[model samples]
Target: MANPPLTPEDQERYQARLQALIVEHRDLDQVISHLAENPPPDQLLVPRLKKRKLQLRDQIWEVEALLMPDEPA
Candidate 1:
């Protein structure tokens, strides 16, 4: 569904949340990459980091959907 128009406060909060999400997404991605690069790494860390990354990805998608819900079908 289309996101309702953002008030000034809404816009500010959205921007803040988006920034935080971006940072978290990037951090999780980096962790996954590091685990991949290192051999015999923390076996559990990879899956956990990847799972966190996926969660962040979902959040990003949700925010993007809110931002431009009319982009396509």
Candidate 2:
């Protein structure tokens, strides 16, 4: 189902949240890379961190979709 239209204030909030998620996402990428380069990779921690990254990606997409204009038929 499509989300209801967001008010201007809501858009601002979402924009802020989106920026935060993007920053966190980038930071996670760096952390993951650093972890991978170490002598021994983390057998358990990497997967959990990856899962959180995936979740952030999904959230980013959702917020982007919300900001998109409706298609005209």
Candidate 3:
């Protein structure tokens, strides 16, 4: 069955949310890099941050999927 189409407003909202998530994910990547380079990094905090980054990535992919139109087979 074909999925219901999204309203314009819904697409706009999803785009905005996706952008925010991408920014956050990028920030996390930089922070992780900095922490790894610095001595005495907080090992526990790094793992948690990495996990959150992964979650954000998943959310990003989901939002992207929603925004994109289905391809005809």
Where does candidate 3 stray beyond 4 Å? 39-41
Tens-digit lDDT track for model 1 on 1-73? 5567767887778778888999999987776777688845457878877888889889988776666536454
Q: Which stretches in model 1 have alpha-carbon errors above 4 Å? A: 39-41, 69-73
Ranked by TM-score, the better of candidates 1 and 3 is: 3
Q: List the candidates ranked by TM-score, beginning with the highest.
A: 3, 2, 1
TM-scores vs. true structure, each candidate: 0.77, 0.84, 0.88
RMSD of 3: 2.1
Each candidate: RMSD to true structure? 3.2, 2.2, 2.1
Better of 1 and 3 by lDDT: 3
Which residue pairs does candidate 1 place in steric collision? none
Give the per-residue lDDT digits (tens) of candidate 3, residues 1-73. 4456889999999999999999999999998898888834456988888999999999999899888878764
Q: Alpha-carbon error at 47 in model 3, in Å?
A: 0.6
Among these predictions, the greatest TM-score belongs to: 3
